[model samples]
Target: MTVDSRIIYGSWNLEEPTTPTRSRLFCLEPIGLGTAYVESLTGYVARLSETHYVETGMLILTQIGPLMKEGYTFDGRAGGIDKLYGRYTRAFNGASNWTSALISALEHLTLRHDLKFLSVLPWVEVIPLRYLLRPSRAWCPVCYQEWKDAGKQIYEPLLWFFDAIKICSNHHYPLCTKCPYCQKENRPLDWYSRPGYCSKCKEWLGTNQNSIQTDLGEPLKSDLNWQLWASENIGSLLATAPSLVCSPSKATISMAIAAYVEGTSEGNVSSFANKVGIEDQQIHRHIKGKTFPSLKTLLQLCKHLEVTLLKFLTEEPTVEDLARASARLPQLKNSTKRESFVIRHNQSSIELALKEALLENPPPSVTELSKRLGYASSGPLYYHASSLSYALAEKHLDYERVRRFEKMRSILESTLQKEECPPPSMQDVARQEGFSVQLLTTTFPELSRAISDRHKEYRQMLKTVRIEKLRQEVKEVAFQLNKQGIEPTRTNVSNCLSKPKSIVMQAAIEALQEVRHQLGWEG
Candidate 1:
């Protein structure tokens, strides 16, 4: 069969469909200026389908080659092709790792070249880990809103395809995996799926206020941040997929693991695997260069070690980096659930330390001691060294009682010496100081009686001074009004004094009225 070069080029869709002097054929240069990343596989398919006036993704996919309508799952897995919807770059055909079927699809269907489809999908050529691609779909509501507002073409970013990416660093909020209206999960490839909207309900995929909630407690927050950290780092790596010259090797990962575990239990494969939430044999194989870890496992291992994937894969960890990774040993150990050995070590260390401290002349209280020793709870001290711990607690209680009595005595002396008014009642003073009234009375009965007697005297003194003050204010207001050639009427006095007529002090108003009558200004 003698094939013409033009026909060969046409079959691969590498040549322009129609070479006109002015206008070029429909070569879908990514809907947006997607340089390094065009759009997700689902998004790219949808755009092409829309352009071809097709209703389903399967129709567009089948147009390219022998793709089964049911087999186009879009879950980044191998189906009829080696990587039908996966992140693999090379299309292996039992012999070579070159001809990518996805690139071929873009070429044939869109009449575009493979290089034109670089950012369109997470090709294994770009991302070596297909396991990082999520089975379901995720979207940032804020990113969608920003795109819509900016009138940019709506497309799913390749970053959202990663299962590790949950939080949107740009929005500082988590991505929505489920639809708010339909309450159904979004899938990568569906029959009538559209980007930036729910397939079932056709609702906009923009996140709402309700989606940014965290059901996990504070203890799990570190884990959440760790996941976010992974998402951010991986997203950054994917952003530079076009310029990525080197893919990470097994030896690079082995070196990072060795550096991370140099001075810790992680040096042991069993311990490292346990901490990384992977099987020991699997970790050992990766370490020995017998196998490579899946993208998810590698991410977990990096997250556990507090090291970035890019740095670990690219360069050897520095001494400072190693020191920092080692420092995380204590924090990481504290953050996780402890084994029997860790618990025993902590208990014994805490007991011995507390016993040594108890021998000091001025012993510390249990709460203060707990803080100083970095113990989250003092229960261990009480459980392990009950006699010494309890004795310390009892001694502190006695000291606290004496201190309270002394504070009460000072308060009583200050109150009695106050001559502006009489002393307040014991209950009022106790309330002011945030002390229990019963506790104060029981501790200082004599002082309590003195406060009560002084409170009565203070009330009488306040009554006399209040009346005198009111009379003086009324006289002053009247005198000023008369000087201004205004009658010292009740309304005038109230207004001049800046007092509301309704809330004018009754005593002051009455006094003004009496003075007005005496001054013949009662009209």
Candidate 2:
């Protein structure tokens, strides 16, 4: 070639040069991308902070928070930071608005579009948010230890955040909620949280022992079997997220349930419900696309119907496949007996029971009334006395509404009466009372508003107090630096404070100027 041509060209093309765009943050690849142990978004944040040698809260407040449409704020106080990492942080790994926002912000920072797979956001349409994620952190010590020992990165998996996953599939060990050292339950992510360490005590959470011993009593074989099934299936569902062509929809699950009912129970929804031991109303709601079944309920349905949850959600089964699956389940002898009992009871008896139920001081629910009437379900009572049943149901609903309102009102009033500095937020109160924020606000508008107003005022007061405290500390630090002939500069003064990051630099600069004027060293 050298002899044949004046210049010999290599295989590489030098004329067309390509330059790769840089990411604002490190493009750290998530662990277990398509596996059951995929890294959680919360864990990814913690890891990213560690890589940058900054605290998790600082990373969020400085780099990521500003990018989010709903900006995150911290008052440079411990209490305010605690609220940032409280129960809402659990939603980071779930299919919630918070998760979606975080995913968008992180993808923008890292230029990695696969961040959505770190959460259950892909299945948001089919998975209900209620009871979707664990309230706090849960992990397997053995898994952590093993990963550390193998020189692999320690991370919290998205599977561990699932409220339904109790056991680790690989080790068959129960996941630990409380830290072994401190015995305290940690939020999913805290300001100083790090993977494989207790957020409270900063102790290593992983165990070095080959066989980890737990305080939890041995789980029953049947319970373990069910737990394992749920864990493995949910894990498989997560693993399939990246490969899914389209996100599964509520209609897909509804159609699957409808097909199964049609094939197994001759299109009688009640019969299918009875066979699966789920409420007929729940089945109807699910089939009508009104509400999706919770993850636990969906798993229970899949278990009884002999269908994998992944398949039940992703693909609709044929009639023959449903029939075969139904054939595998044992005959429901109790269901048949209950159905016959309901049929034999006279409609007159049901009407009489409904009339009596309406007269009770505290009305019994229709289901309870049905049980008292020796009926398996409320369907028969409604069928026999439609108008009376409707009236009774409506009355019971009214009673429930009043009772719940009073209970929430009482609790909220008590909360307001407390002398705690920095009153609890309405969200926290709602969570403690086991109600939704909307329900709390709508049911007791005045009380909810008062509580919210009190919290806002207290928070504002705390912010003012903290800023003053920070300013004083900065002045003292600057004075000390000046006495030492160190030139009371911003950097020097900051280095002298106990928590320099907590002070607003602008405030610090003003304080430093005041100190300099007092010392007759004005620039």
Best candidate according to TM-score: 2
lDDT of 1 by residue, 133-160 (tens): 5656788887887788788788776667
RMSD over all Cα atoms, model 2: 12.4
The Cα error of candidate 1 at residue 421, in Å, is: 99
In model 1, where do residues sit more than 4 Å from their true spots? 1-25, 31-38, 58-62, 66-99, 111-131, 207-223, 262-280, 318-324, 327-523
Residue by residue across 18-115, what tens digits does model 2's lDDT show?
77988999998998999987899999999998888988877876677755532245345456344444567877888765676678789889999899
How much lDDT does each candidate structure score? 0.58, 0.77
Pairs that collide in candidate 1 are 37-119, 38-119, 76-85, 87-124, 88-124, 89-123, 89-124, 89-125, 141-207
Question: TM per model?
Answer: 0.46, 0.64
TM-score of 1: 0.46
Steric clashes per prediction? 9, 0
